[model samples]
Target: MDCGIILPSVSPNSNYFSVHASPRSPCIMVRCQQKEGQVKNNHHYNELPLLKRKRPTMINIPVDRSLENNNIMNTSRVRVQEVEVEEDGYGVYSKKGISRTRLEDRYSANFASDAHGKSKQALFGIFDGHGGAKAAEFAAAKLGNIILDYLRRGDKSMIEENIKNGYLAADEEFLKGNATGGVCCVTALVQHGSLIVSNVGDCRAVISKAGVAEPLTNDHNPSREDEKLRIESKGGYVDCCNGVWRIQGSLAVSRAIGDQHLKQWVTAEPDTQILTIKPDFQFLILASDGLWNKVSNQEAVDVIQPFFTAGSNKPELKNACRKLVELSISRGSNDDTSVMVVQLDKFAH
Candidate 1:
């Protein structure tokens, strides 16, 4: 991945700052110094201060900006896209928080099938990373496949058990990577007119029923009574850091995919729920805590409801996703935000 950073000149002779991404890691390193023999060329050079005399050239890395197919449109800060699925119409939008330079949130949406490609299943998920983005990236790339693999190789009759095991399997696989930090997740699986929703940590899934907003997954925060008890049972304590409660006064959520340091208290087993698609069910929203920290479940649905009132098309869904991200940022949420909208009507039997 290519990232850009701008640095200010510190001395009168300093001409520019050379910035490049580190090959060993994701960090961007900058070398700021005076260009030995460069002459000032701008007419206003004499009037401007050393810092303003010469500006560092910025390199813009263009991401997918197309509206057709499944490509994502990425600006310097935001990325929006329509998922390339044959049946469900869903859109994804994400923005890096103002507090951070790199975006840590990751998402996944696709269809899975058995060996013969007969049983098609839809999966959608959002992952919010803390400390680093590795955990989120790993989970986003692997979780869906792991779950689908269970259904393919294992007993399909015990769907809930299989899903729960699938989560544990993914968590175990992530731990083996020896990566730092962790990620919160929320996923939606659709098959046979059933919407199976699961979550670990604070990422959430909300559904629009008729015109009302209903939450499907409960956020797994230490503030919850059961979560608090579970943490304490593992000999971990929860403390109020500022206004938010955190597990062992370090992590905010009680469950996650990585965080090997706190694996004792931070479990990865998700809470899963299965809902039969009804006529009233309109659409589903999956987002990270960044959006929830500012927008309420009802408010989110209210904002998106208008976009789908006419019809759930790709462009309209993209607009709805963009609006939700913009709304969260406008409300002073500086955390990385990711929002996905899945039209449930198309999946209804």
Candidate 2:
């Protein structure tokens, strides 16, 4: 993908500032102040007055007219630098499905400052598209923003409200499409010293805390008594197939993003939970059923923890994600595969 950076234009009558991003480039901004004095050359120059030997005060003045018109007088420059990494440092890859017409998986991560100076918020997500890739893409692009917006708007005190609003917004966007609807989503927002997780459908989020793997969110499916009751109360019947409950012999999950026909019975809202972040919070793995089907949560955590303990960074996390997808394909998981991994320490400043 081609990426571009945008900068705002500078004003002529005010102090100008500009920021540029690149491996070796320095971010800088220049400020020019007005100059006053007589000058022989067109180029602006400052003059220093002589002082008395005993005690005196000195003054400086500009000597050029053109420099004043061009706003080059008494110019001051500031440079801000950012850490640079190699292109391969991100470590991401994709593969084609055996029978699927198109790739239906997506993953993304973002890092920014959190409440603590040495801590940062790391966002990781996995979107599994069912009927089409539109809903998945829509959720990948907009859900993060909606959640961040809610947090920035002072709604962090209510985690459930923030997650529900974000999921609903993404669902509204997907409804504009004409294709069948189905998307399983899982997200993790790592803040100061906590991990806030939310999920819909079977896509899972598991964390390795103190070498013990634990689920952060409940999976919404018709197999559960509560889920079955909720669906049946809406005049929807659950068909048991292979020990799993299916909605009207169609979907396996009772909750998801799209699936408009089953919207009345299922909900787009996800179950949200917040956990205290501890030193033992080693890593987090988020993946669709393609990977979860072949590997259990604890197994998934076990397979990736070695690399993380060996000092793997963002690149390692990306590699872990791709490896899960590959494992799914090798294990005869014909479904489209999506996987994402997030390392807490890598995000900390």
C-alpha TM-score for every candidate = 0.76, 0.68
**Which number leads on lDDT?**
1
Model 2 global lDDT (CA atoms, 0 to 1): 0.64
lDDT string for model 1 (1-349, tens) is 3333333334444575445443544444555444466453332333222221233344333233332223222222433222222223777777778787667777777575569865456888898989877788788778888988887788877888888898999999999989999999999998888999999999999999997999999999999999998889879999999999998789989999999999999999999999999888989999999999999999999999998776535436766887998899999999888888998765544
lDDT for 324 in candidate 1 is 92
- The ten-residue window of minimal lDDT in model 2 covers 75-84
CA lDDT, every model vs. true structure = 0.78, 0.64
For model 1 the TM-score comes to 0.76
**Candidate with the greatest TM-score versus the true structure:** 1
Error of model 2, residue 62, in angstroms: 59
